[model samples]
Target: MAEIQEKADSGKGGKKRAKKMSVHLDMTPMVDLAFLLLTFFMLTTTFSKPQTMEINMPVKPDSEEDQSPLKASNAFTIILGDDDKVYYYYGLVEDKPELNTTDYSANGIRKVLISPRIKSNDKMVVLIKPMDVSRYKNVVDILDEMKITDTKKYALVDINDADKELVASKTGG
Candidate 1:
């Protein structure tokens, strides 16, 4: 709603001059409508739910006899270290696993994970060992890469002494 007021003043010669008018605008109703719309939208809209990645952890064996050995040819190991360094090997470390270094880029670890040999092997497994010096985000990113590469079998294992030594020798730690 709006209103206009007019005022008349007498000139110096006693003649009446043109009326001066001022306009006022009422914004209370408009403000109330805006608030009501905001509340309605807020109440009717649905918020996004949190997303989570599913991880399958292995169950502990009851005895040594219950454990099964994994084949070296079907294994791939990834070592995560500080400064975004990634070291990978094709098979068991006992066979003198030739450590190759790569990064987290699309053409780096992803390329290795999706290679024809690894992808075609039905029993292929990925072993991820995150060192103490590695950042939390690096672990998460590696996990995400595993998912993106659609690796069916992967495990998060501890950094062993041999692995620590290899990393130390390679990175000059």
Candidate 2:
């Protein structure tokens, strides 16, 4: 009986002196997850290029009674046909402008006018009025023409108020 009690006390003391096991988490998987998320965001991010020009549009007039005027020297109205053709007219919007006959010939519309009013400094504002069935290519071509013609200042006119039939009658495809 004394041997059994001595064995029991020794076993209890040995159990009390045993070292405890500690748990540690591995950080490799967490680091890998962070790198993967960073790569995904880098691949999905979009970069933007700056615009070439700074265009300022005119504000709308207060009342129908008031006729706000646009500068004649810096204005043009471009007409596009359904068959991918272009025509241009220039002057003040308030003055009911007319296009020069020499500007357009058998070849196509001319680039830049040599008139007393139009100079290098004076920017021509272009207003495009496209036909209903006009091709997108035609519009682009007209814009390119505007760029080529030294007519940097331009805008697209809404066809809702424009004469649609006149726009449809431009020559050549």
Worst ten-residue run, lDDT, model 1? 8-17
Clash counts for all predictions:
0, 3
Worst 10 residues of 2 by lDDT: 1-10
> Which residue ranges in model 1 land beyond 4 Å of their true spot?
1-35
**Cα displacement (Å) at residue 106, model 2:** 11
Residue 41 displacement (Å), model 1: 1.6
Error of 2 at 107 (Å): 4.8
The candidate scoring highest on lDDT is 1
List lDDT for all candidates, in order.
0.92, 0.57
Clashing pairs in 2: 74-125, 76-125, 126-154
